[model samples]
Target: MQESDGPAPTSFPRPPNLLDGSRTSLRQILWALVFALTLPAVLIATAGFRSGYRAERETSDRRLQETARALSLSLDREIEKNEMVLRVLALSPAIAQGDFAAFHRQAREVGLASQSRIALIDMDGRVLLNTRTTYGAPLPDNWRESVLRKMQETHKAQLSDLHADPITGQALITIDLPVVIDAKVAYILSAAIGPEIFQRIIADQRVDRDWNAAVLDRSGRIVARSRSPAEFIGQLANPNIRDASAMSPEGNVQSVTLDGISVRAYFSKSPAYGWTFVVSVPVTELAASFQRSLFWLFILVGCILLGVLLAAILSRLIAKPVDRLVAAAQALGTGREVTGTTTRVLEFDTIQKALADAASDIRAQERHREEALARIAESEARLRLALHACHLGSWEYTPSTGAFEASSQCRAHFGQGPDGPFCYDDLIAGIHPEDRARQAEAVAQALDIRSGLEVEFRVVQPDHGERWIRISGRVRSGTDGDLSLVGVSQDITEQRLADERQGLLLHELNHRVKNTLATVQSVATMTRRAAEQGDEGAWDAFMGRVQGLAKTHDLLTATQWQGASLEDVLRSELDPYQDAMRQRIRLRGPRVNLQPGAVLALGLAIHELATNATKYGSLTLPEGRVSVMWAVALSLSPPVLIVEWVESGGPPVTPPRRQGFGTRLIQRGLAQQLGGEIKLDFQPEGIRCVITFPVKAVLAEPAPAEDSAERYAS
Candidate 1:
């Protein structure tokens, strides 16, 4: 081996300074760039603005005019919808048969959501049935003489202007349709809608806050308004509104509003009726665009100053990130790992990560080389360490010289101290007397055939105890041309124990399956006899029994037959009728686990009890309730689990005239399988069942210390 030499030093190239003193300042460059880009745009916009002033005025007015047109169309559709509803109500068969009471109920349902009401008025303007009031109750005289005259003249659905309700005195718009009986107008069916319905429509259209929107009838009266609708409704609109609408039906004009403010008004008249929708804005808004060019001239000078200020701020921000980047580069050159840092700049972050990754890759390569050499030159101590890690013992023998070598683990496998001397005599003495002779024969046979040796045997440890061991070996030639046997041994005592337990479990499973099949056969025979004697429910009863047994078996299988929860057994039988609200049936108990046999018996009994309750006990009545409670009686000589079921608020209970299959199963099966006592009482109030079983026989977890053999046995 050669001695180490000191590390050599090397120099790296330095980067040239990019920020030289002779270069232009970044602030001057930024100002030049901004000035060049914005100069032409500023000039062009300023010249165009003065020439386009008149056009802008027309556009503003036209936009308002279009908004008014759209609002007018929306208002027309709402009135049309109300008219259709009124016409449908007029055609109802109930009204034609003089059954106004029935018609009123139908109208109330249609208008329930809108707060609108329907009224039947005769030709004499007398209010008949009104949905707003109960049938046969006194109604206000709300008939309008003008509305009736107009309806009689048209004989079709028509919309009325704003009117006050006689009872509530609130403004309402009436949609009226006449009922024609035998070629004569007999009655008017009117649906009264509040003015707020139209006000909502204007607000929904997103009219400007500074603007005013209104709906006007043929007389130019305001029916609805966007701003201050309650105060303006039913008042006459601006005088110019009627004059301009009469001439063009839709146009923009200048007028003074009721508040004495000068406004530019735009109106659209509905083609169906003479109703007009008017949208108005202040006159000053139209003239505000004339000074926009002057505003831009001032902005142009401020942008030049802002450009210089921003450039200085940005340069300071970039300087710190540049310093960090330089430090990272120097660290990489010095063969030290580069520490990661964030500057929140994309280009700088990418370069810093690249330098860090290069440093990491170099370190990984050197570490891999060192580890590979170490594994190649591993010594005997390393081999012993590996053997101990895997819980295996190493052994070697030279048949030609009768030499034996063993690792510390091999000494410990025989209950000897790890540092104790172990030879051929010690190895032979450790094997059980019964297995020593057979193991010797196996080794001799393998040597004669020049093959491998594999054998399992029991070893008697002086201090530890007896344990199972398995060894395997193959013959090889040593450096001296002598035959050597090298092998490894592992203690498999736990594996052997598991195999014995599996065998006993198989035997127990076989016995249990046979008993279950016998139970199934007995139930089937009983069900078939009943069916042949004309019992319609015999098959259902048999299936229910089989399903109940399957539920218990599933519960046991989930726990590998260790035990089943008693609450789970009860739920399986009563889950169909279970109520989380605890209104009808209630189950209360302490946590108790039951053995497989007890689980099956208790589950079946609960199933029968629940079925009987559903058919003839508390479950048959809405108010009936059943309470099932259970607890462990630890004070008894042998602790016992007691369960009780009581029913109340049900019909009187009576004992059966003859014993049924379910009754017999609950009475006999629970006692036989659980070795418990059961009492079933059928009192006048309800049926009550009590069950008692030894806790030691049924509990899965609270058992005394048991021998290993007994635990594994059936």
Candidate 2:
């Protein structure tokens, strides 16, 4: 047994060729091939699954964010609407007058309309009126002291945190506003709405069956929940939700629910009320499809293992044909025509033919794509031309990149070069200095609300000229997931100028109407005084004077109130007398234009003189005659107008012992209105009168065509 320590007999192992012939070696080689293919296939499948899951998760998150944002916006609108109602009620005169009964009635009406409870409280939190109760009914001892205090301090509308209402014992929030009177806060107005309203909002915005939505107050208390509102109302939200809500005003988060369900959640805070809205979908639902994919992955792995065994068996027979087919497919993929490769295997030959057919189809598709691009370009060109013709310019601003794109007309409006890039700052710079801050604020508000922008502002050009522009736009998200504003701008300078002119014309018209009313009143009073003094003919004389004034107004109106010619005024007043006694009257004037005021005064004076001539001075007798004439004295520094009225060929003329209303009107009213002097001479032949006034107040050029047409018609 101590045998030879030197060496033991050694047996030689089989050579490589001998081992290759054995079943064990063949089995080992098959196993190695299966593992080599299976490992990479599994790795690729796993990577694909992971990537797909990540994409799905991100999509879900974005959808949840949108839903949350929508819900929050809806809540904010409701709250703002309620606040507006309170503000309107606060502005009521009854509220200012402390007419509690009347204010209560109105508040109750508004409450019924809005489906909410309205309450009026004093600074000390004492309820003065409550719509929830009968008129003059006693209110509960407890009031929303905190809300009242906040509204009083802020002097603006304030929304309260969630609390149990004293009347209904339901979770409610109050929107409070100060009732201001005499520039001081007199009382507080509150609109209390239950959480059930927000619950309805959540119901409307719910995404799907598996999704949950909840609205939370500033203190993290659940005010409303899409599911189990009765149970969750007034309760603190889950810790994770509270933390996430505290972190940001809007975002996505992954967390577990109180019931231990994983979820992807999104939340947004209301800008008006500081309430948070949450939308969540169960993570398990998202994972269900992923689980099914994993199941298929395992089955695929088994099939791959079986295919490895068959592949090893068929490897030698089809190797050359498959290699040629692969080479041909590679060439086709590289955009080269497959011409030379040939394969004897039926499957390989069929694959080669299919590859060649696919290449042809691809070339045809390429041609179609090029044609589509050309059409798109043509359409864009046409759109640009249309915008330019309309004097409208389109623009886009990407906030993330601070990039701005503008049409040619838009650049021109901003006084920018056509070739250069312009940004938000450039747009602001182009705005007039007076309007720059206001426009910036408008844009900021639009962006914050994600709403349309409509503003009219002035833009200063390089030459310092101002042009009014109206910019109207809407907020949208771009393809790259960035916020963008797209809008159109239009030149409105002509429109603004037209508006100003219209305003001036209205003002002038108002002034003229007031002056005419005063003159008519004075005439009526004077005539009434004369009639009271037993002059029965004064009424008829007054009517004739008013008619004279009306005739003068007609002349002025025809000329657009610019002025009236002295000749026209005289002719209009004396036309009736001239018709009655054609050869008895003579009128002469050198186109002397009279201001509207002067026209009224001088027309009345001529009417009085003609009346005297018809009644006694000259026209009483058929042979009697009268002459009226006017002339301008250019020798004076500002020039002067002189009008003479002479009557002749009548019975003996005598000065009246007592001045009548007509004589006084002719002397005093005419003098005061024309800012000049008047003389009345009673000569034996007839009555003679003279008027002298500065021509500058009653001088104008020839009327325009339109005015002349109106004058001829008058």
Candidate 3:
């Protein structure tokens, strides 16, 4: 279905209704009532029958389990009593002393005096004496080792399952008790009894007529069967009993297939012997009672359904006015009102009249909404005009729903789809990565505080490539009780580029100003020192220093205040003096790129240091050496620019209290402009000035290899 902006248009004709007014169709109403009433009744009856059957099956299983438990407990008591009796007899002094002859006579009088079969066996399980003449033969293999091991290790009574005697072939269980003398096993007293003695106890149980009970041995083999013949004995039932026997010796039920029919098996285990007793009953038989219960349940359900049908018919007659009111309200929701659709049913007809009134009220509200939409359209038009003038576009975002909408210029700014406005995510993706994190953080903080955010960031445009834009946004509470972000964005590309160009020009101007200051300082130093000289010997030296200063300033002017090469400055300044001599100088340092401020400061400082050396230090003699080397010390507290103007093989040097303008300029002027500490040491050896400054303040450029060689050659 197409989502209509408002109510649907009523262009199509309405379909004709067969039943109208009070003359409703009897056939249709009757059919609808019958289906509504009987469909649920039938389903409920079926569900009730299933629930009853399951409940009965579970109850029957519980009953059978109870019967198995009772049988297992009774059997345990009987076996325990017999085993206890034998154990007590085995501990007799006559038996523990291995006085088998005395034990045999006493065993016959005490144990075998009745129908019980008793015997006295040695530690090796050799039947040395027997009360019954039937057990006169040697012990069998099955009983001999078991009896000996029980006496030696456990020193407790062991009750064996019903087994056929080797000699008499009589079914009996043997109870063997160990005789311990001074904590050492000496003999075993054995007693055999008919299994019918234990069966009599199980047969006396008052179990249900359908339930059959049986006692199982330690290995899950049936030892005794009640309500059945011996044919069913010595057989295993469900394996769940055997599996649970080692862990849990208690009553439980298991599902099994018995006699080709599914049956629930209930079982219990003997705590004394680790044997499981199981009882199984057919589920079909158990469900008989539930089947009879469902019969009455269906009858009760039918009567209730008949009453509900009559009630539905009466309720429909009574609720005619309510139905009309509901229909009237539905019409209003669809932007239509039904007039005079009222009834005479007391309370219901009053509601119908209210619905008619409500429909009228809705039409008034709709007119107001239409008028508001008109005003919104006008405002939006004016906003668009203003946005166009400023090259700006507006947008709104609802964070709770992640919904967003933007204007035409916003999409054009980021080069998004022309037909559709740019999504908020698309706009975010256009932000430059360097500035995206800060812009995103500002947006998030504004959303949290319900305030406004204004930020500028670079946007990757489609046709124009990268352009900077300023976004202004405010978070407001919307009508839906959720925060909505509404914002406007304007392109600031040209303004940002203008700012960058202005910054570059200012930087260049600052470099030119500093270089000009250095030239003035050099010219002043040359004139002052020339006037102070007392001899013509110093006049050439003063002219050379002025030339070095002029050479460095020429390099600065050529670069237009941007930067200059350190090697070019050094070679130009030294060439005038070096051309007359066939001598050389060595210069070494990193090819450093410098800013304009550092360029002028170092140029003048190097000129002064070299001039002083040529006058009175190493450069005064032809055999003297002038090595100019500069390096960047990265491991300093702050990185520093270090230049060494070492003069060797000349007259001895001494410290001077009064410094010339040249010395003062290299110490204070360089230190002040470069923002670093400077030290000038005038030792007897040479003049060493170490300058420590931040890397930013140094004006350095890569020194050409040819320029460095020329400094030495000339």
Give all candidates' CA lDDT scores: 0.76, 0.76, 0.66
Write down the TM-score of every candidate.
Answer: 0.44, 0.39, 0.34
lDDT (tens digit, per residue) of candidate 1 on 95-199: 889998888777775532266888898998888988878987887665478878877786657777777777688887787889877546899888888876778
Poorly placed runs, candidate 1 (over 4 Å): 1-391, 400-412, 416-419, 558-565, 581-585, 589-596, 620-624, 631-642, 649-657, 671-678, 683-685, 692-714
Predicted candidate 2 versus true structure: per-residue lDDT over 1-714, tens digit per residue: 686677777866532221122243233454677778788998898788778777776776687688788788777766755654564466466877878998888776553234478888888777887887887897864355666666666666777888876656766787778886644677888777877788778777645766778889999998888766777788887888889889888987888755566887788998657889988779888778678777877787778878877877766555566667766765554533445354443444445554775678788879989999999999998988888788998999877788888887899988888888887888988998899888888888888899999999999998999999999999998778788889999999999999999999999999999999999999999889999999989989988988889998999999998888777888898777774536567764445677777888888888888888888888898788787755554433455666778788899998899998888887766777667777787877778777778766656753233112111111
Model 3 misplacement above 4 A: 1-52, 91-116, 124-143, 235-262, 305-714
Single out the weakest 10-residue window by summed lDDT for candidate 1: 705-714
Q: Between 2 and 3, whose lDDT is larger?
A: 2
Between prediction 2 and prediction 3, the one with superior TM-score is 2
Model 3, span 493-612: residue lDDT tens = 889889998999899778766857666666566556656764354456556555655666677778765667656666666555563543546655546656655666676677777777
